[model samples]
Target: MRSNIYIGSKRRLSIIALGLIIFLFTTGIAHAQTVDGNKYQLTLAEAIRFAKSQNKLVQVATLEESAAKEDRKDAYNAALPAITANGSYQRFSQLTLFTDGLSHSTTGPRKPSANGAALGIDALFNIYSGGKQRALQDEQQSRVHLARLNTLDQSGSIALQTAHQYLELVRLNDLQKLILDQLNRAQTRLNNINSLYKNQKVTKSDVLRAEVVLSNVQLSLQENENDLTITNRKLDVLLNIPDSVRIAPVDSAGMPKPAIDSLLPFIESAGVTAYSVQKIKENIELQKARVKGVESSNKPSIGFYTAYGLNYPNYLFFPPVNQAYAIGFVGLKAQYSISSLYHNKSKVAAAKLRERELEVQQQANNDNVRTEASSYYIKYTEALTRIAVNERSVEQAQVNYRIVNTKYLNQLSLLTDLLDADNLYQESRFNMIRAQTNALNIYYNILYISGNL
Candidate 1:
């Protein structure tokens, strides 16, 4: 019975020990996760979103659009009546009638006092401006549309820039990984050489050569690390994140499928929808409206004005009286600028010339878009082809490295040959990574050029 009791105590102790180990292991893993959280892992879409939210260029475009909206509102309010108020006080030397012998106050006229004051409010509404008001309103609305299109253009620019930065960061990160792997292989090679030298199978020179190769790999590693750091900082600036924060992109899903051959439809459609093209079209409309406004300036403008007034020392009477009176009047007034008829002919001609210039400019923009779209599409296709070729090169390089490494391990090949093969292997991998990044960048470039970004 004592033996059974001792065994039971041992079993309980074992269970407690197992539980403690599990708890410690879980705590360590949790700590590691907490550390990783310090770095922000950004995806391509998220980076674009962040840039849109915080980029100064995007913000500036948005503000410009808002200002344009205010201008449009002002144009709308111009159609409403305008009300004004005025008050004046004057101390004249004397009040005299213009009639003959009005200075003979003792015989017939009584002179008024020197003081005069008046307060009045007037409201005027332009009943017609010969289409000037309508044309101005249309012009402002077109400007508002142009401003919106400009905002879209800025947004596309910022998104494309962010995407490029992110892709570069990914490329650098992968490059660092490749360098680290190469360094490990170099170290392993050095150890093997050292063992062979100790056994007298290889010369001291071989060991020294291996050491030099490892050092070179280490230097390369350091260079890649430096590049990674700079890339991270640049991406942080683009994201508007704190410079101290590190950002890393998770493994991307790779490049999107290319429809380069069918890109003609997209390119052709872009001319009508692209911001630059649309802005030019709006400009043409705005200039035409300006011509109408200038033409209207030559026609008669009729306005109705009404005012209520209080005047001290009324001057309406024959002799005048020292008293205050309330008065009101309303009337229609029409006036034409005879000089506008002569001057506006030239002005209208200039405006029409400007409109025609914009039309020509718009045609140029359309042609540019077509050329740019086709060029980017071709570039994207070329990048895709390069990726495929690099993939095959990487495979061949891996095989060559393995054969050279095996021969060196068997003391049948020189260390220099092995190092050369390893360098080629590393270079192949780097090239492949660069090709992939280039392909992704070109893909986005196509989208940007097509105005689909």
Candidate 2:
């Protein structure tokens, strides 16, 4: 919300305005932006780094992290002794010790010259007040720790989402290419059929079907290209970059090849890691609650302070005289409000209940995290297998299309048969690419589960 905009640039404070208008208007932008001029160049590592540093959500996490660090420092400082200093100066027309007109000598009011100043200092070292200070310090520390852990949790979430978006963009790019390829093939077939019909070797229906197929493919390609433009804009906003910037996807050769053998180990490790980290954080809170309970039971407090001034008189008795006295007194003191009997039965009970609640929550979290980690691991391996099988299927489909087209040219296949085979081939290839992209994403998903991404 706070930024220095170039002259005449509207304040882009909300997604509704930009997303509905300028950001979505990707008329001049190309799909798949590249950092360098290398061909086929989007990489997982690059995406991860870019998202971590540049994503709008990631920036918010960074700010929370910075604030947490400051809070931790303040909590740590609370353990030290507290010191305070105060000073004041004032003047009055008269300082009355005793006045001349009392009840006639039964009382006396001494006249005093009017000026005074006070300077005082105090230092209260926590000798020990039933552990209240320590408890408060612990609570502060726990809150700080929670801020950091939560940031990491959010980081993992953001990374997973970005990876998904990036993978889908890649899919859209590949699908667009496939659509173009299909369009070209349809046009070539249409030309062949028309030539054959001119020689009285093909039916009019064959020419008509080929032209229709080409028209359909062309229309689909147009829509796909538009969708790709929109996808690129979404990615640009995430990267905090200009949406109109050009972009292009890398080839399959750059996708990650995960270590399949470690899949189970990674899952197990993620489960255990989550449990341990959560226990460490939760225990801190419980310990703080217990410390507070003890301090309240001890029922102790204090309040005492002293202030003094240098003695000086600027006026003389009756005849007017000037005098300054060099005198000062320093003293130390303290007071206590100790309970005569135990009075906090409810607080102790609440602390015990709170600790029990954390224990229950810890157990619940372990169950949930284990389930998710295992599921993610199994999904990774399954996706890998799917991609391999789908790739082979697509290769075979390509061969089928080539053979069918050649047969049709030789008058051995029907026009409908040829069109259907081409459609199947394109669809198969797209499926393969999608499976591969998803597999690559699932493999990296292990890091997200372990909170290491």
Candidate 3:
């Protein structure tokens, strides 16, 4: 019974000790998270959503898009028939009218002769107008298409900026961590160096060098912390939030990028080419341009009209007089300006120039986009290589630092060796961090170009 009680007590003690360790580790982690820093953790999707809804550039793009939509709607509605209703009432004072040939020998003043009210409804169905309306409609549609494309472009630009800034913030944070770790190692080395100097085993110069290195690292850390603050403020501004509110970089770990071939094809095909996204813009303009050509060449537009009216002798909306007069008439209206004054020629020339300009702009955009795609692809590859190389470097530096520290303590290596290894490890770790961010940024940039943003 006594042995069993001892075993139970030991087990209970082990459990209590394990609980304390878990509690302490959890508390430390929580405390570290609360440490003074500007990073407010945000995921990529979350940041994108915030920017889309709140970013200033995005707001402008959205407003312009809405206006373009309204213009397009108005243009389309112009294609339908139009109707108007009009009403009028009029009374004439007593007068002798000479046009009626009643002015001769009129001894007494003529009484008021005509008073009437009339209501009419008229509608115009554009039978034909040299394709003018169609051309106008098409032009408006093209403008809308251009506006939409511009909106996409704006979004892409802003997304790329936001994504790049996010990555930079992450790199800054990693560098801060790397510097802190190096400072700790430097402090440890300083302690050892002081001990050896006290025993006359090491020179004072070694201690001073270590202190300088430590101080420099401390300064770098402080600068990086400041940069982190700046990044957070800028990000908040991009999100249109209060600058005091902090935002951290999104984690870029394990993000999948689109295939380069697929992305390249998309960039290549996005201009005046067939199956291009910008084809809508081009086609709408082309349609408008052709109709304008026809309209200008036709030179004459004719409209036919007829109307009938009945009038009573009273000026009330409800005619009071019983007597009524009825009249009906029909007529044809036409317009043709005899012109060799280069107006038609100029219209045609301008239309052709505009079409060519749209084509040229699209071509230039194609080239620009293709060049950007290739550059970003190359950048992604380089960043990935850098991350790999830097990861190995960090590991090697860690091993070197550990070995040299042990040797220095045992008096087998110099203090300079230990410091060098320590500095190398810290720099390599920060480089790795920066490379990780660069890789992620390039991936997001590619997505923006590909219209995935």
Candidate 4:
């Protein structure tokens, strides 16, 4: 009786452990599902924001902007007085002097010290550098401005790219559902055809035709799934997300279409406020500054210089002194490079040419921006038109599909007619989705080209 009681306790314990394991497993799965569900949900604006922050191109542009800032600082520092301190120690093995006379004689210090040390601080402030200093400073400032513009440009580019991929993913997601529905329909039709064949109502050829349609649809679905995988991975890289995470674009159904009454505003904005245009303007300024810098080389430079020092053996005196002595001096210095007058002519011309080249480039960029903006606007309008047309087509195709299906069921239509109607319905739906996504993409493109995205 005691043994039976122990066995019963053991069995109860075993059952309890089993139940605990099952509970933990179920809880873990539920938690994982919740986390994964939250992780993959993303909106278009959120995706663009994430890409701007995490894209490698945007990050690199930001780093370049930082470097340009440092360059500006260095240029500013160049305008300030340079101060430096230096110290030196030397040991002399021997000290000798020669006296110039009819009978040449060599002399030595009475009590020469073997070691000598010196310390000094010197400062030089530029009073004038023929405007070179100002020109260089201006050039560096222009560089900083250009870098900032470049960062903005890169951020915009990344945003647009992210939007494209995100929209494509959304399109694929929608298509996936539509294709699945088509697959189910195809499967049902095939099953019905088989049933009809068994009952001698339809021939074996009907079953084979249905099978082919199903196979083609299955292939299409597989291709779309592959495209989804690739697009998701690309978006993950842009957002710096883990590959294991899958993104699900928020449904854009019933989202209001972007509206614009005219393309003139976009084209105008692209010419004035576009990052490309701004960068070129800054580059032209930079080239002008460089020309000034080169021309300044033909002029003279002037500065104030001062130095103070303490030396162990005062070499300033004719006779060597054992005690250390302090020495200081201040003076104005000026210099001219005679060769620069001739040598810099070519350099100045080259700089001016470069400035002109930038001006030409600026004009070209303006033209390109206008053209690109107008192109996108036109495309956007075209997509809107397509959307309307495809909507009507989908409605008509759906009606036709229903009619043909009913006729086939009533033995009043051939299987081919039903299959064709089904194909038209699926194609119309696909086209409608494409038109919607394409319109969204082109709308964003317009914003991107105008630098307003």
Q: Pick the candidate with the highest TM-score.
A: 4
TM-score, candidate 1, is 0.84
Decreasing lDDT order of the candidates: 4, 1, 3, 2
Candidate 1: give its CA RMSD in angstroms.
Answer: 12.5
C-alpha RMSD values across all candidates:
12.5, 7.2, 13.0, 9.7
Candidate 1 lDDT, 258-340, residue by residue in tens = 56676666667777767777778888988888988888987899999999999988888867888878899999989988888
Model 1's number of clashes is 0
Top lDDT: which candidate number? 4
Lowest summed lDDT across 10 adjacent residues in model 3 is found at 29-38
Off by over 4 Å in 2: 1-41, 89-110, 251-256, 275-343
Tens digit of per-residue lDDT, candidate 2, span 1-453: 234464224444233334323432343333334354222234545555556656778778778878877876786687576667676676755323435766334433233535555555556555545666667667766766666676676667777776776777888888887888888788888889999999998989888878888889888988888887887777667656666544555545226667778677767777566634554555758566565846554556543333344434544255433455433333444444555244556667667777777777677777777888888778887888887888888889999999999998999998888888998899888878878887777766777776667
Q: Compared with the true structure, what per-residue lDDT tens digits does model 3 show for residues 196-260?
A: 88999888898899789778878987898899889887877776665655665446543554454
Summing lDDT over every window of 10 consecutive residues in candidate 2, give the lowest-scoring window. 23-32
Assess the local accuracy of residue 294 in candidate 2 as a C-alpha lDDT between 0 and 100: 62
lDDT-superior candidate, 3 or 4? 4
Q: How well does candidate 1 score on lDDT at residue 60?
A: 88
Q: How accurate is candidate 2 locally (lDDT)?
A: 0.67
TM-score of each: 0.84, 0.78, 0.76, 0.87
